[model samples]
Target: MTIYQKVQAVNHLFNQLDKDLGSFQQSTGLGCVANCGLCCLKPDINATALEFLPLAYHLLLNGETEQWLEQLQNNTEDKLCPVLNKVIAPGSKGFCSDYAHRGLICRLFGFSAMLHKNNTPTLVTCKPIKEQKPEAVAKANAHIASKDNYPLISNYYMQLRSIDESLGEELFPIRIAIEKAIYAVLAYYAYRELPSKDDIV
Candidate 1:
C-alpha cells in the first residue's frame, strides 16, 4: 500500500478510538482537567512512526515538512513534544499545534487500558484523574474489570501493527517518531507525485 493508504488506515483506527474514548468518558465521568497539558509535558512519551503519518501528511500539504524537520533536528531536548505550541506555558496551558493530526498515542493516552499479568485491563490514566475524580476512576476500573468493551491499548496497537508491520511495530520517543514519519512521507513522494487533498481521500 502507498503512504497515503497507510495514513488513511491509521486515521480510520484513530477515528474509532475517538468514539470509544468519548463513550468511556461519558459513562465514567472521568476526564482530564480543563486546559491540562501535564500529559503532553511528559518527556517519556513514546509512539510509532505509523501513528504520525497523518501529521506528516498534513505538514507535507502545508509545504512545511522541511521546515518542521529542520526545527525538530535542531531541538536537542527530547523532554517535550515538538508538536506542542511553544507560546503556551509548559505545565498548565499546553496544547498541540496540530491537534487534529495528532498520533494514535495522543488520542489513546487518557482513556485507554493496558493488560496486567492476569489478563485484566487496567485503566491507564494520569495523577490528576486519580486525585480529582477518585470515585469516577474507581468506576472506570470496575467497568474495565467487568469487561464491557472499553478500549484496550494492546488491541489498538495490535491493529496498528497489522496496518503496516515495519512502520507500526517499533516505538520511538514522540519527536523521533514524528521525524521518522516526516521522512517516510517525504521519501515516498520523492520519486512519485504528491497527492492533493482530494486525492488522499
Candidate 2:
C-alpha cells in the first residue's frame, strides 16, 4: 500500500480500538480523571513512527509539517511531548493539541490490557486510578481476566506492525516517532506523485 493507504488503514483500526476502549471504560467504570494530563507529562513514553502516520499526514496537508519538523529537530531540552499544550504555571495538567490523531500509545495507555506470563490478560493502568479507585481497579482487573473483548496491548501493537513491519515495530521516544513519521511522509511525497484529495476515498 501507499503511505496514505497505510495511514487510512491504521486510522480505521484506531477508530475501532477507540470504540472498544470506550465500551471497556463503560463496563468497568474506570477512566482517566477529568482534564488530567499527567500521562501526557511522562518523559519516557515510547511510540512507533507508523503510529503517528495519520497525524503527520494531517499536518502535511495543513501546511504545518515543516514547522513542526523543525521544532522536533531543534527541541532537545524538554522531554514532554511537543504536542502537549502545557499551562504557563509549572506542574499543571495540560492537554494534547492533536487529540483526534494521537498515537496508539496515547490511546491505549490508560485502558488496555497486557498479557501475563501464563498467557492471561492483565489490565494495565495508571497509578492515580489504582490509588483513587482501588475497588474499581480490582473489579476491572477481574473483568479483564474473564472477558475477551477488552483491547490488548500486545495484540494492537502486533496489528500496528502488520501495517508496516519496519516502521511500525521500531519504538522511539514519542517526539522522535513524530519526527520520523513526518519525515517518512515528506520523503514519500517528495519522490512520488502526490495523490489527489479524492484518492483518499
Scored by TM-score, the top model is: 1
Locate the minimum summed-lDDT window of 10 residues in model 2.
85-94
Candidate 2 on 1-201: residue-level lDDT in tens? Answer: 989889988898898898989898888898887667889999999999999999888887777888998888788777788889876345544487878889999999979999888888888889888888888788788888787578899989999999999899999999999999999999999978766655432
> Backbone clashes in each candidate structure, one number apiece?
0, 0
What lDDT score goes with residue 3 in model 1? 88
For candidate 2, give the lDDT of residue 5: 87
Alpha-carbon shift of residue 140 in model 1 (angstroms): 0.3
List runs of model 2 lying over 4 Å from the truth: 88-94, 195-201
The local distance difference test score of model 1 is 0.87
